[model samples]
Target chain A: MSAKPPASIDALIELLAKLPGLGPRSARRAVLHLVARRSQLLHPLAEAMTEVAATARECLNCGNIATGDLCPICLDDRRATGQICVVEDVADLWAMERGGAFGGRYHVLGGTLSALDAVGPEDLGLPRLADRIETEQVTEVILALGATVDGQTTAHYISDMLDGRTRVTSLAKGVPVGGELDYLDDGTIAAALAARTRL
Target chain B: MSAKPPASIDALIELLAKLPGLGPRSARRAVLHLVARRSQLLHPLAEAMTEVAATARECLNCGNIATGDLCPICLDDRRATGQICVVEDVADLWAMERGGAFGGRYHVLGGTLSALDAVGPEDLGLPRLADRIETEQVTEVILALGATVDGQTTAHYISDMLDGRTRVTSLAKGVPVGGELDYLDDGTIAAALAARTRL
Candidate 1:
């Protein structure tokens, strides 16, 4: 079989396949489509990919992606609402933003504290989160974590860590068990954040 | 609401959203995931993407993506089997290869001849294909286009153009109506190729 694609094209297909929901089959299709639409899609995408690859980095303060040391939300002083919304991942923070309801800053935890996975507060930047609560003069900490056991455990730990110092709230309603924040619609995220209940 | 993401991250999201099957929501999630998995997934993917973006180009002869002017398949003298598989796009050719069934080289037509879209034989590379047939001593031309109206029309036109000079066949059976080769399973594609009858 004259099946071996060029090394560069093969590399792209392999990388694309690693993305969520894209297996080898879909990746091959996507790469082919990009090649066919080279001028409109492939070239632009490749250029953008190169640019982003060179510039993208994590915001030092918020764990959000940034071109510089701080993400936009973290840098903007006007975003300080004395409320820092804590999330299991950056996707959750983006979901909160898509709701257009949150006015404060975000603290992406990278992932929930998981005993099975050997993930702890340190791994999730909980110490840094506590420092933010004190330094940023945060009055509230809203937990927008997944509804899984590890998520709840992590939320409880954070609440206890900040006990008596600030209000700790969890998004109420809409989120189901094992439901990822990225899967929630904007309306759902908005409603849940608005109806947040003290943990 | 102070919901806007950083400019560079937002740009990445916008580009990712344009990918096939990835909407805005999924794109954001995907970007976030990449950021979190930077060392393991993101860094490598970014490097690979950058390298490919810089080096990749279309094979002048067959439209397959390559690092050089001509694709490896087209450059290989041993692959000159006097048979060229004519696919509507490069993805179809890739699909055939993934099945490890085809032994001949490929000619990506870029798209099927479609009058509705103001496309004709020239747009689908029929002129170059004819040249390849004559110059390469191609005795057979396998049509691996979709089962759509344009696919059939283009196949008929190519057969007429070659008229009695070479055997014309298509990847047959198991391909549903309007089904693209990229979507089919490897087993199904193999079966289709094996059962392919003369067109």
Candidate 2:
């Protein structure tokens, strides 16, 4: 029992463990599952990863991930709605897409303006955002950043930088669509109450 | 936003979501992380998966996953200790290996007998177990099956079948190590009390 598994299997487990939600134990289980169903899962996953590794790239325009220079959102001609939804990372962009409410394009900031981590506006593609407003004729900049302190700070910085260029708005604060008042924290409840609208 | 990502990226997400612990949302995150860090994580993982897919196979003798016809445990002469640890699945075999306690080889039954699923001894390689006892001169057969009804039933059936051929034993039933008495369930507490020793 002291003998370890094969090197490839061990390496796969190590890499799988580094994924966001999977720890070492579950990674090992996942690797085992993949190995057991090789033709069905492991082979397809390997092939898919190889293909992505060869083709996946960040959009040169908006920093969204795609297989080409411009992401699908950035390349779509019909997405010219004169509105650019700004987000902290590609994950946020995907989240916004999942909501299926935004009909415009996106500007991925890559990260927030964090003074502690030394992340500045330049690092977040603020210059590119301003350029996009002029070149793409954007009339609105929707700040879909998180509710965190850094997120707010970043939003404020972007808004001030684009004060005269375009309208700057933010995603509204309220109890989530399916969330309950009982489960919400004090700050959320307060914000939701303050922003309450008439029926 | 209506435009889908490239076919490869979508395929990767779909395959990843089918893994043991990952769902659609987390799969997207995992795929994004892989694509973003292609050189660091994605390429290596893809290579490892390809290697494992090409080499990994079930041991013809004991059903453990291996690179060849027989698993490493079966091939190692040191593991010929005239004892066989029987388990319901390869996961249990790996768990036992992680403990580094067992000194003998293992026999993965693939799954426990289930009346509802129409599983039987033949399906679990019971005949091979009997043959191995005679050919390998196995003096002990340890049943390391789960505590479920099907697991227990399978264990009892195996024990009865090998009544006089070899000494049959089961994993000890008691409170797990590092477990608190107050948090233990009624069945575990009762079992611990019944199996209490002079220590």
Candidate 3:
């Protein structure tokens, strides 16, 4: 038999390969899985995908995903805690959520202010965030940005913008939570130990 | 803030969490990613999912996946090479495909017959396979089954049913597959070497 896959299957595989962490091999496997489990898995997944395709939208206010204009977190009355955790992207927000420590809503910046990429405050949704701070009566803004240079720069700029009106703090740096001490590099260990001023 | 997700989102996550290799954490991250890229990734994925959900089917003959009555492999005239590589599952078939060695169609058994779990030949689709052997003029049957007891037992049963009418072979055993050999145990290494034969 010819080694090439059918055009429809090949298209499906190509699209699947574009997903994060899904290479051509993995995409092929996943596509086959979808096919094998067509009734119980593939069909349902397709339906859900279609439904999400049509209804999925970003939360205009906080940049979180939502089926409607606002995401569930933004819509919940209980989440109106007047404190917003600012993140560089939804991934960071998810990382924070996985910690299950924070109890306030979030503000996704979409991306950082990158000089290399020519990304700026406008692209990062700083203006919308400011407006949210005022309308939502936000009293504190927690900066949960990454430790990269651009992440730091974005944090500083946001901190300055909300200096007096809203209290500002950033995610603690030092030891990565789920990491073991043995895996830490000397530089990281030194930085963590050095930053151990007070709890 | 409220700890619970919205009803619809929560329902979606629950279902997503059940996908192979996905935990609640990964499911949440995936949903977030889909939402973030709604217009590009999310929308397209959803549409694909929907179409598949509606039209996806399983091959009645080989237990493989199909968008129609039979999977493309089963339908292609060129693939009717009178050979069917029997596998314990779709994943194994996929693994073989990745190796790019086999050039014939496949028969996904869905699972090996398990007596501990009370599985019988009927449960594993041996009846349909027996019928396929004669109807499809199958000349050689390759048993690419797992090394587990159930996998071996299934292979023996299949070979017996063929009654020496067709050639039967099994994938050579010994090497630790899908992983580096460096991580294999001494017993596994010895077994692999002992089973080695001239090609």
Query: Which candidate has the highest DockQ of all?
Result: 2
lDDT per residue for candidate 2 within B8-122, as digits (tens), equals: 8889999999988999989989988888788999889888888898899899999988999898999999999999999988889888998999999899998999999999899
- Chain A TM-scores of each predicted structure, in the order given, are 0.84, 0.93, 0.88
Which of the numbered candidates is closest to the native, going by highest lDDT?
2
What i-RMS does every model get? 2.4, 1.6, 3.5
Q: Which stretch of 10 consecutive residues in model 1 chain B shows the poorest summed lDDT?
A: B1-10
Better of 1 and 2 by TM-score: 2
Alpha-carbon local distance difference test for all models = 0.81, 0.90, 0.77
Model 1 misplaced stretches (Cα beyond 4 Å): A174-199, B99-101, B170-199
Candidate structures ordered by lDDT, highest first: 2, 1, 3
Select the stronger candidate by lDDT from 2 and 3: 2
Clashes of each: 0, 0, 6
Per-residue lDDT of candidate 1, residues B34-124 (tens digit): 7666677777776766666667788999987788999888888878999899987767777788887777889998888877899988887
In candidate 2, stretches whose alpha carbon ends up further than 4 angstroms from where it belongs are A175-199, B180-182, B189-199
Candidate 3 lDDT score at position B163: 74
lDDT by residue for model 1 over A10-82, one digit each (tens)?
8888988888867888777777666656667766665665566667788899888788899889888889889
